[model samples]
Target: MDHIKRPSLSGLTGKRHSSRDRSKDDAAKGKQKRADSPLIHGQQANGAPSPASRPAKAASTMSIVIESPPNIFFGTPTQSTGALFSGQLRIAVVEPEVTLQTFTMQLLATITARKPVAKDCPECAKKTTELFKWTFITDPKTLRAGDHSFPFSYLLPGHLPASTQGMLGNLEYHLDARATTRPTPSKGAEEITFRHPLPLSRALMPAPEKNSLRVFPPTNLTAHVTMSPTIYPIGESTVLMKLAGVTEKHEDHQQRWRLRKMSWRLEETEKMVSPACPRHAGKVGGEGRGIAHEDVRPLGQMELKEGWKSDFDDGNIEMEFRIRPSGHVRPLCDVDSPTGLSVTHSLVIELVVAEEWAWTKRPGVATPSGAARVLRAQFQVVVTERAGLGISWDEEQPPMYEDVPASPPLYPQSTAPERSTSTSHPHTAGSATPAVARAAAAMNGSGDMTPVVSAMGATQRPPMERRGVTTEYDGPPLYSPSVVPQAVPALNMGGLNDALPRDEDLEDIDLGESMRRPGPPSHRNSAS
Candidate 1:
């Protein structure tokens, strides 16, 4: 048995298994070390933050609460009283107590250009102007762990340009606030900043429509345009155009300009001065200097081959069309800023007029003369937002108790004619009562005569017997024996009696003659 010592299959298998297990353990240990190692650049191999990495906590937070109404200038810059802006800057402290070293808020007007002089320079692309500033804390102040409010107010000048976002540039207003905490025993100084964008607008009251005229030299061609004083972005604007002096007669042959094609374009021009920062001041000549840039683009356009009434004999061409700003373009309103930022709109109309010859005797027949001319005209248009029902702040406020009147206004009394007294006629033996005479007089006038029949019928009975009312009547019967009775006219009662003519027919009748000859009462009148 000692001659050959061979390892047992079980022992060999166990050794192999132990070796494989040890290798696997070693690999597991290596992976655990790699996982436990410090991350590179604060990230794991997958580029995700490590579990131990955490965001730094802020010592304070800031928020803004606007207290005043919307910022809207009610009239033109020169006439407006400006708009009021009021708000509160709230800071919530997280620590037990924090000492604020400096706290300030600023109202900044920033102008940004899409096309800058220096493309890589931030200052050339954007310029910010400080309109107003508020210093909440000039000295170190302690605040408890709670919310603190700092009220701020400013009157934005009316002349200041409103916030606008244009295709070539942008004008914006911002409320920027910064709060710095004093260095503490356990923490370094921390900064808390808050920024809120504020939008401003101006409303120009509607004025009368404007009429403009342009005359082309040496051609006897003139254009008359009538348009609204103000244009809106969302609504349609009518443009009325009349072209006169289009025909010229030369004895037998007449030359006339015929309208062939017309094109209208609404152009938005944006002008801005791209200022440079101190670092790049030399690039734009010097500090406070900038490169002037102007950009023109069309907001809307249209072409018409035929939509106008042309009269060669009358020597005139009339056209009416509606134009609206493109909503997709988001056209900017008119703005003029002292910071060298301006936006304007102009309506350009181009007409292709071709000359034609026709005999004065035969104006309807004409032939093209192969001579064509292009007539171009431009008109300045004011584009603004709708004023709507929103009036100025001062005008919208209710009247104060001291300013209110003590009592309501007094109205003038109506001057109605006084009732005339009844007078006895000398010719008639039995006269009608005052009511009957009044009714007859009313029928003669333009007054309604429906009450006349009722009034006269009431006179047939005694005043005490009528309507259960009593009154004194010394006059005789309206138709009595003393008065000579005239012949009874044939009554045509199909629709209305001829005796009682309408108001229109009453004008031809002789009222005095009818009143002189009294007629006997009819059976209908007596029954009433």
Candidate 2:
């Protein structure tokens, strides 16, 4: 009985040991199934780490932060270039110890100056020039999971374009930051990066592109002005103005038609209103309404001498005005505010001896010398300085509408697209509307293109009477192939055509074939 029992127990023990071996085999199979997993790269069935798979860098972390003012000035700030870009950058180690081998911080701003790609390839896009940039490296501080910060400030050059949003071929500005890191025992290989844009706005009001404007309702004056470019450079501007008498016939000889004195003055006006939020005004012991300051500064004034002395006149006065050294032309700006004030500028012309005929008049423009009949004409102009600012240009092409060749014959229209009197052709980018092309073509080839005579050029009128400063400003109809002389061969023709009031600079106007039947010399004042 004892021998039988011993054998049975031994057999039982053997069976138990075999069951344990089966369980071990199952565990081993599970391990085999997960052999390709990242977590099991060097682990065995019992979760023991493999020596070969035990590499460096157990864990790591990194981050970057930038601090700046609560608000950004979208207007020209007080600086050399009038651009104020300021902020602070912070580098930090947020996790597992990092042994920084090399650390760097870069500040960069990009501007897109995309001109039209090949006329046929509209899909193509491109950019050029680095608007602003700065770079520096911090000494490896062995950031033991702490932080580091750096401050930066820059005044972009004045000539730098304004910050534009989504305007493909226009000015735009943005900021970028990048960092490089080395791998460490506790920190693996990594990099920290951040990018944003510095908010800014520039006032670039292009001068009126329309060659001439007719002042009506308020005043009886037909005026034409020619600017080399409405966008005058560095405040160096020469304004040539011509005024015609478009008033109706009156009973009195003096009241009917005569221009005595014509004067243009540069006016700078600054106004400040109660801010919508007058939080500070109330604290200053004022009625919640804010304190205000307003001032109008007259830069300089020029008068056309012809009106004062001309013997035989059919009521036409020409004047050339210059930006005086003392004159200040403010940058054109449209600030957003319910009550905040701003400084503005304009060219104001005061025509004398026409009060009885004029529909509009200035209340207190009387001179002690005589009965002043002042009719006024006002125009806004954009002014800026280019000191220490260098211009950037693309190698392939110039940076303007006038620089490019004419399309559908759109050569002389050197203004904005809306103002350009060119035809819009589907194939070419510069062409304009169908009606414009037809009109331009007809005017270009025909002799019937008589001068409408807004403000006649040098070839038509005598040299402008110079009293103060000598200005070289000439009137326009500035054609490329010399269209003025060639287009109107009738100017050389005799009889009524000669005495039919000859004048250059019509700007494509059809008065009629028989200018001889003129009553008031029908005039048009284009305001665009």
Off by over 4 Å in 2: 1-208, 212-220, 226-234, 246-256, 273-292, 303-315, 325-341, 354-372, 387-528
Give the lowest summed-lDDT range of ten residues in model 1: 420-429
Candidate 2, poorest ten consecutive residues by summed lDDT: 419-428
Native-referenced Cα lDDT, model 2: 0.47
Instruction: Please give each candidate's TM-score.
Output: 0.66, 0.32
Give RMSD (Å) of candidate 1 vs. truth.
Answer: 14.2
Best by TM-score: 1
Error of 1 at 9 (Å): 33
**Candidates in order: C-alpha RMSD to true structure:** 14.2, 36.6
lDDT (CA) for every model shown?
A: 0.81, 0.47
For model 1, the stretches where C-alpha displacement exceeds 4 angstroms are 1-30, 35-53, 138-141, 250-253, 278-287, 398-528
Q: For model 1, what is the C-alpha lDDT against the true structure?
A: 0.81
